[model samples]
Target: MRYRHILAACVCVTLATAWHSKATDDIAELPPMGELSRAIGPMVETMLNGGVAVGLAIEDVSGAGMYSHRADEPFVLASNTKLFTTAAAAVSLPPDYRWRTEARWEDGSLWIIGHGDATFHIIDGYSYPDHFLDQVAEALEARRIDAVDQLVIDARYFDAAYQHPDWPRNQLRRRYSAPVSGLPYARGLVRIRRGRSSVYSTTGDPIATVTNFLVRGLRKRGVKVERARRAGIREVQPPEFTSICRHECPWPLEKVLRETNAESDNYLAEHLFKTLGAEFHGRGSFDGAAEAVRVALDAAGASLDGFTQLDGSGLARAENGGNRASAATVTSLLRAMSKHPRGGPFLRSLAISGRRGTLAHRLDKGPMTGAIHAKTGWIRGSLALSGYMRRDEDRVVVFSILVNYNAPHTYDRRQVVLSFQEELLRAVWDHLDAVDTGWEPPPPALVQALEPGRPAN
Candidate 1:
């Protein structure tokens, strides 16, 4: 059954109503941005005080546009870049695009070709397809193929830049840090579910195992487990494990995208990013994927102006270098996407704070609790939010806020900063005819960070 999250619907409505009053068209443009800044100066002051280096850009999709503060400057977009990736995929591929993971038998050997299907896994002895190995076994038995052979795995689609140098080294083994693959299964996760145990050991120990059971399940299909791991390319052997057939996957592409977007799964994001690269460029290297995304954006009529991309996944790696996106560019892309055929579904897939997916609990009791449907990105000191805001009369507004160099205090880093952001959004929500320019003093934490911290490199 499709997961119909109710909160998603409610939040969409709130945002739609919030911006309904103002002319969506540019004809009724508000006073100059300087005027708008003065109107909301108090809230902006609060954000700056809390040590948040923020850049926000909000627009009326229908008519006149107005912005306040640094809307033209570039800021680290973080995972908000996923919007570009998703938009590219939606436009380039047919609605039913499906990544193919294959197994081939030749001579006495078996070959697995990974087309970057990130969810390959078996849990508690149950493989993802549940019947995947059965298909392999059936094919082997039908051909009277049995005996021994080596398993050949191909990972040539992606280069060896597995870990990003800028990320904390300790995070490499995390699921979010899973390596991008031409054929990824289970997001390359070695599931490590742990629980308190009655075992005599005082310390809680983790029980970790690789799901998808690709190699192990193959052994069950009459193929001898001769070195049951990925080795060199083009493995060869005499006819041992014969008769291989393909089985349809359990999850479809839309289903996969829904889950990935809802929970902000980085592994899936990277896999999909590389998959697009491989599909379009014939290679899944980071550079290839990056190039493919740029090409896709250009094709979509997005200005490639002032855009730099080092990695498709945006995993904060040194190799990815760092890229920035101006508020204007982000909103322009959102506006374009909303007009696209699949825009509705794509927008609906993001998490709504205190409502669905990864954001179900955040801002649960706040003013905009059920009104913000956004993609949130956080890595160390960076925080970003981008998505559609639905106000009165079904008015739709798209906004992006990128905050870096968070303050050191608890309130500054958390509540105060979020409060300032929400306040700005509230003004947009109410469509207060014109912005309030009186600036609010920043939170103490933010004030300290801004004054004491070194300039961001």
Candidate 2:
């Protein structure tokens, strides 16, 4: 069921009362933020004293105000930026959207076109069958094409610029900063293990690597690839190329989103981001993707003010200003999403605290454990956690917390910032228990008197 539907009756009652209630009366009835502020104030102050900037915003799921401290100010989102990217994708792409790897026989060659499947193979602890290429091989063998004159890898679906320009150049080889390409094999990652040493490598040339991998797989399956060469990836459908087979990524878009947000998969996030651009804006470039996301969010009733769309993975930080998003902005976005037709799937895609994803080890033993489903992000001195929390069966809250530490002692300060964030979250969770709902059943006497045959007091 959509989350908004679950709460609609309660929300409608609240709204109905608001229509007749005085504005001042409504303001007076809101749950006091003082207790929560007081509980979390020292923790926030400790971070501030230690040279950290914290942005926090919290509200009931109905978009009712709860608390705010620097919540309107923008801070670097780190991987929290994935929330925006994935949300936009969930709205733009259909639920069945699957990255397609198409193979066709053309001019004495088998052409494999990559549509940039991020989950092409097992990576980041998610197990996918290692035999995607084997399936293609089997398809070719069944067609009695024992040998192909050449194997052509068409990877031009996305721009040739593999890596985002704003990413840290030094970290390009790491799995987290893997390049984005039209054809990403093993999520563009390769691992080499020696007798005593192991190393990880990101494919510098994704199309070439995938092409070589396919050749090796086909040969293993008794299909001969006499020659393999790279070809330009294009969106144009080749009418002359007869369809041989199509290999689909293991997971659909929903699972892709779950993995992206839960594990903070940079490659998947960027791949989907570019896909958004390619599908909606007619270009897979970064600018196109950013604009596509903006358009999607705007269509969803989200405010785009002060929001900057950089790389989909949130690895890029603004050079002149902070990558800003107000707490209200994020909460509103979440609210809109919860009410969206696809809200159930989209909300389920987030990481459940203490259970799985990036939050497996966090909030594991607290009152909030198992109640919070959020996206966690960390980049040097920046940290973010934002998502929904079921305070109880009857109460739900949406929150966004972003912390940026300016201190040079980042390693030591990170722990302090994280502690404060956890403590603050607990405080909010506790505060929800004390919140007063303006809705109460009418007095028993009044109800009885209103009945047709009841006597008045």
Best by TM-score: 2
lDDT per residue, candidate 2, 1-457, as tens digits? 1212322322221322212333333233333457775676655544444445667778776677677666766778889889889999888898999998888886678888888787777756754434566666777777777898988888777788788777777888888988888877877877779889988888788777777778887888888888998874534545798877787877888888988988898888999999998899988888888889999988987766678868888887757553457666777788777666655556777776677687777777766666777888888657888988775555677888887754453344555556666777778877765655342332232222112211112
Q: Summarize candidate 1's per-residue lDDT along 289-365 as a digit string, tens digits.
A: 77888888777776656666555445663433475677777777776666665554465567766677655765455
What's the lDDT of the predicted structure labeled candidate 2? Answer: 0.73
lDDT of 1: 0.58
Q: Which ten residues in a row have the lowest lDDT in candidate 1?
A: 199-208
Clashes per candidate (backbone, < 3 Å) = 49, 1
lDDT per model vs. reference: 0.58, 0.73
